[model samples]
Target chain A: MIIANTLADGFVVFLTEAHSWTNDITKGAVAETDEQAESLLTAAKQAEQTNVVIDPYLIPINIEDGLRKPTEYREYIRATGPTVPIPS
Target chain B: MYRYDEFDARLVTERVEQFRRQAQRRLSGELTEDQFKPLRLMNGLYLQLHAYMMRINIPYGALSSKQMRQLAHIARTYDKGYGHFTTRQNIQYNWIQLKNVPDALADLAAVEMHGIQSSGNCIRNTTSDQYAGVARDELEDPRVYCEIIRQWSTLHPEFSFLPRKFKIAVTGSPNDRAAVKLHDIGLRMHQNEQGKTGFEVIVGGGQGRTPFVGKTIRDWLAPEHLLSYLEAILRVYNLDGRRDNKYKARIKILVHQIGTDEFRRLVDTEWQQIKDGALNLPQSEIDRINAYFTPPAYAQIDDETESLNEQRTQNPAFDAWVQANLAEHKVSGYSIVNISLKSPKLPPGDVTAVQMDALADLADEYSFSELRVNHRQNLVLADVPQKDLLSLWTKLIELDLATPNIGLISDIIACPGLDYCALANARSIPLAQEIHQRFQDIDKVHDIGELTINISGCMNACGHHHVGHIGILGVDKRGKEFYQFTLGGSSDQNASLGDRTGKGFPADEAVNAVEKILNTYIMVRNDGERFLETYRRVGMKPFKEALYGSA
Candidate 1:
């Protein structure tokens, strides 16, 4: 999975299958193999150069119960929101 | 309340315009993220987990009523209607959009405040005791020297890019409520043999990865030589401090590598060149800064002891608040009222825009239209009249700001952990909320008596966990959230780092471990001993036994 923060607002964004950024992690494109992940990251870097996103990186994912999930807790947090409630 | 002169106002205004242009360039794709990151950070703008976070400095923890109201307006207009007050006496907005930041900076500049020097590799905002001018025990107001240091360090061309960020703290009282021993350089004011006031210079103290209790470099330094002495120390550090590794770049690491005596010798050698140079503070300049902090006009009135006792006998709730929150003021009819933002219902330092506005109004009515932010993440009305104690308490209760847990178990210092900060390994605020929930009973908390529990999301120790009586540091163990506990720390005049207990606990079990430790303290405490005193007397053996079942 390729993830980055949008440049304008610095909000979390994920690369979709159409090579565009989406705010929802569930709708993000997933790569099955290392080569696919590398290619996806390379495409994301082009978007970065075009001033769409910043610090694009690959986050490993696991398919659990027919849903994709982030492997690291940090990525999981970034994908979802904060584990605690924030002021409304 | 140091009003900005023309130079100060011009500097801040120009900086805001510069930031506006930089932000525009970034938005218009003229500058890349790499180029904009440093520029934004120099203005105290950071991209955290969720959104852009902005940290605004509150010089010497002091804020006038107008400034406080302006902050409230900023929170309501530009942010998510709230702000988080940090342990450095600064306020952070966790959800600021990058596009709105320039306008926010302009708003702050209108009130003589900005985020400059609040971050970056420069001398950050110099913190002083929250009870600076009002404390009965202080020799003189430290904010005078704080403002002087602020003027000297802001945009200082020579020391702007040091090994890393530098922090200085000053305290005028011998009791050391400002946590001076945990700063990069600590200035403790006292009288010499001739009864002339000066500062005791302590160098290279900090609280991050490698914590060190500051060592005294000079027994007594005359007030006139303060800026020159500081320049000499900064010059030495900039010349020899390590820059290869970011972790080892702090002055504390340099002071530790080379012995304190050697560091002092180097500073002295540098001081010989610049001691009487342009950096030396003239008496007239000192007097001019001192005049800004002259005591407010106090009316001639008797102490309200008899009336206070009558009210105390009638109202136990007010009495409890009076006992826990009020500090002795130098003036007979006055009291220092601490407003606790550490209610179990909210995060430790989080304050809503509504609360800020109401508190500012209360300050205008009760105090002298002035409020202060403490390093403990609480607010202070420095000059409340004793006669108005009941009325003030009544208003605070209505506003949900009357938590009587100052210096008690429920008063926890917590950093914005993984929930907001990108550097965090585990969530700190939720754990703080958990501990607070267990200890929110006022009677039970008062019985614990003067215990400090500081929580940091990671080893960065921004929450001052190293000096907590019971410190909890959140760690990621095998992809799970775990917490490590430290015991027997104090950040007062006799400051020391906490010693780690045997092993770490899971998030849920950490709270139980804290309970066990406190239960042991309650079981073994002497008649008048505090939690720290009992732990110091008995050592960590009893606590280790209770937590790990006598293994």
Candidate 2:
């Protein structure tokens, strides 16, 4: 999966199947093969060039129990909010 | 407490407008992320793991009541309802939006504060002792020198783009509460044989992947020579410090590579050329800056010991707070009250907008309308009258600001880890929260006695974990989270990096490891020995035995 922070607000977003960015990781476009990953990253880069997002890159993910989950904990944190409760 | 003059005001206002334009351009697709990153960083805006984080400078850890109120407003208006007070004596808003940052900078500028120099490779916010003028043992107020450096280093074209970010800290007292030995440059004020005060200039001390206790370069430098000597040192680092590898780019690395003696020789050679130049401060200029920090008018009064004892006898919790949070003031009737932001209910150093406002009000009412942010991630009400202890304690309790965990086991200094930082390897906040929750019994915490547990999500050492009595660094073992523990670190007058225990503990077992270490300390400690002192006495033998089973 390709992910980025939106250029306007710097909020974490995932590249969607529609070549657009969504804040929800579940809605993010996934790739199974290296070629698919490269194409997805290329599309994310296009989004970056168009100023829809900033610093786009690929992140590993798995379809666990029919839910999209990031492979790395850091990436998982990026997809969700902070693991700990923030002060209100 | 230095008020902004016309030039300072104008500089900040102009910078805010410039940043406003830059942020607008970035949003409008007129600038790429590559182009906008540096500009945003210069304004102290960072794109972190979750959202944009903005760092705001608190010059020498000092804030007026008005400034504090403005910060509260900024927190309520531009960000999530809270702000994190950092170890550098700065405040960071974790949930800031890039679009909101320009306005936030404008808001900060209204009160003579800015995010400039809070990030970037320039001289970052110059930190100083929280009890600068009020400490009983201080030779001179360090904030005067801090203000001078702040003015000189702001947008300093010569040293803006150095090998890496540089930090400078000053301590007015010999006690070294500012952690002088762990900064890029540390200035320790002391009297010479002639009773004249000057600074002992220490250079190349920092903590990260590499930690070094600063070595003194000049034993006694006259006050006038401070700026010139600093310029000379910075020039040496700028010209010769490594720029190839980011890891090996700090002045500490350079000083280690080419010995400190050689680095001092180069600095002295450069100093000879510029020592008598315009950078040399005049006594009049020093006095001019010093006037801004003049002691507030204090009334002649007794120390209120009888009344304080009466109150202490009545409320045990307030007594615990008084015992833990109060530091002696130079003045007879005044006490330096530390308001611990490390309540287990919230993340360490995190303060809500409501809390900020209430604390500002408390500062105004009890402390001459002034507050100081300490490097230990606590707020100091520097001038609370001794007689007002009970009243202040009651208010703090009402506000949930009376945590009485200063210098105790639960008083953890932690950085925003994988939760917010882009460079983090594992989560620090949750670990800190867990450890803090495990030790919430104030009686047990006080029994632990002056132990510091610092957590950093990565090796950047933003949490000062290298100098923690028990340092916990979060690391990733493959894809799982693990923590590396280091023991016996101190960032005091005698600063030393902690020794690492063998291997890393899995996240679930990390707290159990801490419990066992504490148990071992309790078993072997002598009377009146601090955790660090006990550790130093026993060496790592006992700890290693307890932790890794004698090998």
Show pairs that collide, candidate 1. none
Worst 10 residues of 2 chain B by lDDT: B439-448
Per-residue alpha-carbon lDDT of candidate 2 for residues B261-281, written as tens digits (9 for 90 to 100):
999999999999998899989
Best by DockQ: 2
Q: List candidate 2 stretches off by more than 4 Å.
A: A32-36
Distance from true position, residue A67, model 1, in Å? 5.3
- Residue A30 accuracy (lDDT) in model 1: 96
Query: How many pairs of residues collide in each model?
Result: 0, 0
The lDDT for every candidate, in the order shown, is 0.92, 0.92
Question: After superposing candidate 1, which stretches have Cα over 4 Å from the reference?
Answer: A62-68
B85-109 in candidate 1: lDDT tens per residue? 9999999998788889999999999
